[model samples]
Target: MHDMAQAGLTKYVAEFVAAATPQDLPDDVIALGKKSILDGIGLALSGSVAQSGDLVRRHLDELGLMPGAATVIGAGRKVAPRFAAFANGVGIHADDYDDTQLAVASDRVYGLLTHPTAPALPAALAVGELVGASGREVMLAYHLGVEVECKIAEAIAPRHYQTGFHATATCGTFAAASAAASLLRFDAKTTARALSIAGSQSAGLRENFGTMTKPFHAGRASESGVAAAQFAAHGWTATDKILEAPRGFFQAAGGGYDENAIRGRLGAPWTFADPGISIKPHPSGSLTHPGMTEMARLIRENDIKSADVKRVRVGTNSNMPNALIHHNPHDELQAKFSMEFCMAILLLDGKAGLGEFTDATTQRADVKAMIDKVDFVIDEKAEKAGYHKMTTIIDVTLNDGRVIHGEADFGKGSPANPMSYEEVADKFRDNAAHARLGRSAADEVVALVRDLERQPSLERLMSLVAKAG
Candidate 1:
């Protein structure tokens, strides 16, 4: 049974690798790819100046690899595909504020901070340009990469996640490899071998949370994936069945998986179509965003001053601790994982933006006082739906005895309640604005991404990212 499963994974990996390309990809897929690219670049540029981002750039510089194929969005330097992928991946995750895949159940089931921006974008861009793949081809590879990453997360999630593995980092290597392989038009055999290499190389530790190393996991995974595919292209081999064999990815890392989850919904039932994916409104943890938005809305609708609120109690699920790791985060990155900090800031300021996580914000005595008053209540029911349905029920007990209860069922940017195109564009522009790209540059990136399939080449897209900050 294990042998057959390995053979099956190898076969499918090969097929996906061989047939995957942007040339014939659907328009929606292309649009999604471009959107992801724009978002990644925006995030990367902003993160480039972040303390962690700068550190990664320094490390990459020390590696002394040949400068080549692709650009690392913020750094404005070109390097080998692997190093580029690594550095770019770190940029995307630096803020701890990228995309996520919510689990169906359990805090033990780690909800993946799944698709960060730079990893897939750089890998696809490098491979596509190197192979002379059109702009459309790059988009296809990206969409395919995201799809692969999300599916793998779903397959091993809750179980693998419970075991304390970062699904994005652990599984992302294969996802990136698959995307790069698709762009390179590798044979199925090579694709399978790439996946095999990725599986073995996959790693991420939960202990790394709230540290710079967490982002390193993302960058390294992407670099490894790109390297894996490139190595396979040269006839390097890996174990045939990386996902399904008794000793494969699923069986080894995945504590006890639903075997059906691995291959059940290959194409017909897609992760992209259901629960869809969240486009971040703020760069903080996705689990906390909804509550923050709702609290901010409540405070605004009632014109509640920050001083009026005596105490704020936020009710969520058991898994929230993962999202809100710090009751008092030492820095912006730590604050991003703190639920109390998120809620307090939302009510105090009524807006959660990029600057919300800064040291100045964290040091604000008012914000600290509010954060101190905030307490978390875990509801088991909310835990079952995974992090997706994090019901943030906030009861503000005022000094004047006005008890207001505000509950948010769906997080902002969730498919149940999504951020609009204008909002996403606005977010992209805001981040890009810091880089001084101007309104025209931001608009051009959005417009080009919106109609990516029609573009002759991704040169314009790449050019925008290569902008010096």
Candidate 2:
């Protein structure tokens, strides 16, 4: 056999996405997929109404587009499927509260995996709606997208993230394309072209993490995916071997990649099922969840008042300090990427939920004091444990000479400690309520996704989430 690494990798991946069917998905995969789709929908609703939400809910003219057949979640209007994908993707990632992929590679930083749902689901929803496809079609398309994206993420050079590329936007474009291509019913050759085209469009930067531009990356990736598929359907030209070309996607973008990560790995275990996905319980960078959980635990168990605490020390692997860039954040967006702010908010509020991450909360004197009290550091032990694990150590000092210690190796909502479907539904309810969605409609959306395979079309589901409920 020819070397799989240096030849036909693009066609190989494209064939998998183009041919995978619902029969390949087991009961549990569908169950977890529905949960993730539900989470993405809920987050998109809340994201549609944030203070910076106007960035998405704008006139089509401002977006340089006209109306089409696809729904923009919560926007009460239809737009081109690509544009719908763009807007809804922005909403899903706006709060950084969507589902995150988990990589098995030791060099990959914990919790920094691409926010898979943010890009994949929007593409599936947009194109699935565009084609009047069944719910199973959409579900299968989304799973295929996530699987391709996660496998690609696993194969790429670790320095891709270390050198500041946001994997969500970079790898996610491929996810979006795969999802869209699946829904569009493109053949393997056409899908290969789409994947190649998506590689050219892939782009995002870590420097944009704390601003609206961050979510915009996910939006653009989703949009680019939709556009790439459409372009290929129209016979757009591109190298079909983009992923394996001598100077192609992996080489140009990430320097190199591990071919073994892709060979026989696409659906061998279903990345969504094997390594699994994470539904963020908090609306911040997932890297902070472990510490946030520990902080919440400390306060809950000890009934420790913030005023009683003299200082807080949070330690993690060295990579975290670099990625959680906002050392002393002053806004909600910045606070999401700030370890200090997340810990402070959890300490002050006893839980870092939606209402607690407001800019007003960040600027509060007490919150500011708590921020100063947090000593965010790089732990030698955590560093030694390897970057693949998100290990965090916490030490709380009370003014009364009491010290509390907590360590978290895995986040509460991770595969190791998964939230049940019921729990995910609860989060969906809170997000829908945050977006002003009616309880009755929100309940129906949950039921619809829960029974995804039985549904004939996305008409009801899109109608519920796409309109201003």
Candidate 3:
């Protein structure tokens, strides 16, 4: 640990990844980590049924890419570990429903830090299965990957996201590499080089939001992690000071970064316990959740109908307009990022689940009319709440000219208002059923994950969840 005191950011991170062991996992971490992993699997299974996810699966089938021993979730087959990671990553994020890293700083916007589980968990599962790792080892690898990814995200300047980069894909490349290297027991030097290799591989654009390409960023990042670790294991060369170097990742990608966010902060507080993470209650963008929550609340408490609500106004800071770009969505993919669509659906159905995001739902006359009645604006009041909070103010005006005010700073599954474990289980069952997994299989998957750290291996767990009957 003392060695990290004098090491550069990259070297410190590499050493942290190299030395992680499941034996020292705290009780709290074990509990949250298992739930996070379980949640990732559920989202992946549910997302696999999506058109984007099916396309990725079909592409891999077409290539018949190198046959290896790695399970592709919902695909009922094994492929190369890298390819499997890619497929699973796409599946996990296909609906934009994966768990998100919480924002730590005021300038850091919610939902932009990264989707902590998407890239990291898929890499851990693919690599762990390839190497026949124990269940604890795989879970530990996943936690380590998330830790490094979050720290890097914190260290980077907020402008990185504001300037059109998708942090989940860019930061996630490093996360996947960290997980793969940790699972493989790469030495410190190899770990450092793997991270360095990942820096070059890091890529994702904000411009790709509202399309299948956005999820593809998560897939590519996961696959790139596998490729980088494999490359580093074979003595691939790269600068050891990838993070702190003048022209290295921090400066090249983000212009500048904060060293304090990295130094001695790798696992000292553990990312999950401090800034914490949010499990999404909705499949849409995190930015849209608060508004949806407020709208749903106003409707439910007031017993108002969609037709009775003559006008609605949703206001947030300027950052939201850039992230939620789909003003009018034509399909489920775009609906995930459309504030207008999200609120309209919640107003109409009281909830927006996987079943409500179809293209048909988006084009319904009532839905379209509701969408037209809502306005998204940048408000000074929301800006006053600061960027760290996803502060959303909702103003609903009824046809009778009665005005109702509602606001939500934290969405349903936020740390301030967490979901119970049973709720998470219900979510898992719903998603698993959507993917066509039998109820018995879904129950077993939950049981397996509940005691994941004690399981002998990933064999039974992955078998139940990854492959169809």
| Candidate number with greatest lDDT | 2
Q: How does candidate 3 score on lDDT?
A: 0.86
In the range 235-337, model 2's lDDT, one tens digit per residue, is 9999989887767888878888898999778999997788899988898888888888788888899999988999989999988887699988878878888
How many clashes (backbone atoms < 3 Å, residues ≥3 apart in a chain or on different chains) does model 2 have? Answer: 0
Off by over 4 Å in 2: 1-6, 63-66
**lDDT string, candidate 3, 329-437, tens digits:** 8888788889999989988888887888888998899888888998999988998887778789999899999999998888877777676677788888888988999
RMSD of 1: 2.8
Taking the tens digit of each residue's C-alpha lDDT, what string does model 1 give over 1-469?
4444335754664576577644555544444445556677777777777787778878877887777777777677777778778877887777766666545434433335476354566677667656767766777777667766766776664667665787778878877887788887877777888888888899998888778888888888888889999898888867877777778887788754555555645443445455466667787877787787788778878888878888888878776775577898767877778888888887777777887778789898888888888888786655655554667788889889998888777777776776666677788888877666668777888888777667777667767777645
Give the least accurate 10-residue stretch of model 3, judged by summed lDDT: 1-10
- Better TM-score candidate (2, 3): 2
Q: After superposition, how far is residue 358 of candidate 3 from its true place, in Å?
A: 1.5
Candidate 1 lDDT at 435 equals 60
Among all windows of 10 consecutive residues in model 1, the one with the lowest summed lDDT is 102-111
On TM-score, the leading prediction is 2
| Candidate 1: residue 28 lDDT (0-100) | 48
For model 3, the stretches where C-alpha displacement exceeds 4 angstroms are 1-7, 399-402
Q: On TM-score, who's better, 1 or 3? A: 3
| lDDT score of residue 295 within candidate 1 | 80
